[model samples]
Target: MDLAERIESLKAGLLGAIAVGITFTFTVFIHQTLTVSNNWVLPAFPSSFEDLSAWVREAVAFGSGFLFGVTYRYIIRQGENPHLKSGAVMAFGLVRGLAQIESISDRFTSQPWLAFVLLGESAIVFAVAAASIDLAIAWRWIKPAS
Candidate 1:
């Protein structure tokens, strides 16, 4: 690709990353609120912000968003309009499917309901984040892929 094209790709990727990161973080906050309010089952999250696991989870979440953003950018570059819907379907489908494995595993045998709730929450978060990121790009709030 030419220099301008390369620069445009980089800008698009960065925009996607920022959009996804913010959206995912917001969705996760919503999920946490719901979890606390409903007393839902959750993995043993660190109780303290200073805990290693807490930071690790934060990093993982952001990393996941960044990856998703990059992927979404590529998808949009393929001439997909209604990009938000396409990205949401792809993102949520993959996340929900992967999340189901834990919910169906023998590990959650004693509390299948917990697994169900967790899976539902995951679906909601992924869908919201995906839609938010794509919409931002579509609306030019985020730079489009060249």
Candidate 2:
């Protein structure tokens, strides 16, 4: 890619990452609320909010979002390929959701539904990131790599 294309990708990636990061934050908050309400049996977050682990998780999510943004730009470059877009979103979401499912132990067997929740959350995050990238492209704030 040329320097201009690289810069545009960087800008679009940052925008998408920020958008996904916010979504991640909200998901974490939802998890926290569920924990407090005893509706969720998983310890996805620390008892105290904004702990070191929480920040690390958020950082990872943001980094993943940036990668998704750059890759998605090329995946849908200048075309309306709904199949490819859906596939891309499913790829990311399933990878994350499957990991969550795998992490569940026998002790968490009663809470099998957690896996679906995590899977849905993953899909939502990526979808939001994709939408943000599409918006940036539509607004002419960034151009897809040619």
Candidate 3:
């Protein structure tokens, strides 16, 4: 790809990353809130936004977002295919969700329900990221790679 095309890819990726990061963070906050209010008997995840581990969680979320964004931009390229877009989102979500399930299984508490919730959360986050990227592209804020 040419230098300009690479730059456009970077722009698109950055936008996607930001969208994913924000969505992930919001979901986490909601999860924490629900867990706290309901006293859900899930595995010991960070249940409070004020906890020290929240920083680590945020970092991981955004780092994952950056990776997803760059890959997703390349996957969809300049195509307007809805299948490609939805497939990309599902691919990322399933990978993340399955990993979480495996991790939960390794734990003694074995909160399978929590894992499913995480899976759904992953899908939502990716969907939001994809939609945001599409909107950005349509608005000419992010030109897909040529």
Candidate 4:
């Protein structure tokens, strides 16, 4: 209703949008970069080495974006709440990021630059999502205690 609340809500939407966009875009770019190269390949991990593993990886990479929307909203809330601000968004996101980076990175070593760009993009997305994550926590999109 108020100006501040309006601004927060708008920003929340933007952060969520950005998170989903970054996750999907990065995954696609990484997938293209790897698949285009017939030499470099992804190693077997949770599943057996097969085309199915690659497909699953593709799905997971894209799905990781879902977390970003929530992650960013919570990060954004931190600035609004002193309590949330005290807790570190980067540190918190670090845990989530591990899976993200690994899930996304495993299949992209074929094109070193593409992988690097993906990483750089991830950092920017993280920065954006961190702010949103603070907000999400403050706004109750995610648990404050988390």
Q: What TM-score does each of the candidates earn?
A: 0.61, 0.89, 0.84, 0.37
Task: Return model 1's CA RMSD, one decimal.
Answer: 4.2
Clash totals, every prediction:
0, 0, 0, 22
lDDT tens digits, residue span 1-146, model 4: 46655454555555555664555455555555675675443332222225575556545533444454444444544446644433433443454445545665655565445444444444555555555555565676544322
Which candidate tops lDDT? 2
**TM-score: which candidate is best?**
2
Candidate 1 clash total?
0
Cα lDDT for residue 39, model 4?
42
Candidate 3 has which clashing residue pairs, if any? none
Using TM-score as the yardstick, the better of models 1 and 4 is: 1
| lDDT, each prediction | 0.56, 0.81, 0.74, 0.49
Regarding TM-score, does 1 or 3 come out ahead? 3
Where in model 1 is the C-alpha error above 4 Å?
A: 2-40, 44-50, 79-106
